[model samples]
Target: MTAKIEIYTWSNCPFCIRAKQLLRKKKVKFTEYGIDGDEMVRAIMAERANGRRSVPQIFINDVHIGGCDDIHNLEDQGQLDKLLFAHSGV
Candidate 1:
């Protein structure tokens, strides 16, 4: 039940780097959308993020998980693993 992970980011963003680092540390493969200077992509990401216009927006199994700090907080709370591994088996 490997959950599909996705992230939207701009190049040279530290939060994106940190987010990817966490995924690497967890040994997870994810799809990354680098939206450098692309307003349309950023707009879509913002809409998906509930108006969060920040880089490093993340999703797991289509569930919005937010940026690096949000992810770290979830991990600190011992819940990131659950999100990373959850699958509907569909």
Candidate 2:
């Protein structure tokens, strides 16, 4: 089965855009939360991010993958694909 993914972002955040681009390139479908000025949504995102308080926080299969740089780091290490297409083999 495909891994579930989610991302918290802002409307004009470059990091968010880049993160989406990478996921799209990988053909991974993810739910996005654009919390630009919404304090309520930011609060929730912060809680879920373990007090990270940063934009572009991501989650894979309910596991927090952190921000754009973190995901990019995973890709750099040649490991992001493993998480995106996890199945019986993984």
**Considering only N, C-alpha and C atoms within 3 Å, which residue pairs clash in candidate 1?**
none
**lDDT to native, each model:** 0.90, 0.91
Per lDDT, the best of the predicted structures is 2
- Writing each residue's lDDT as its tens digit, candidate 2 over 35-63 gives 98999999999999999888999999889
Where model 1 places Cα greater than 4 Å from the true spot, the runs are 88-90
Residue 87 local lDDT, model 2: 69
| lDDT over C-alpha atoms for residue 45 of model 2 | 90
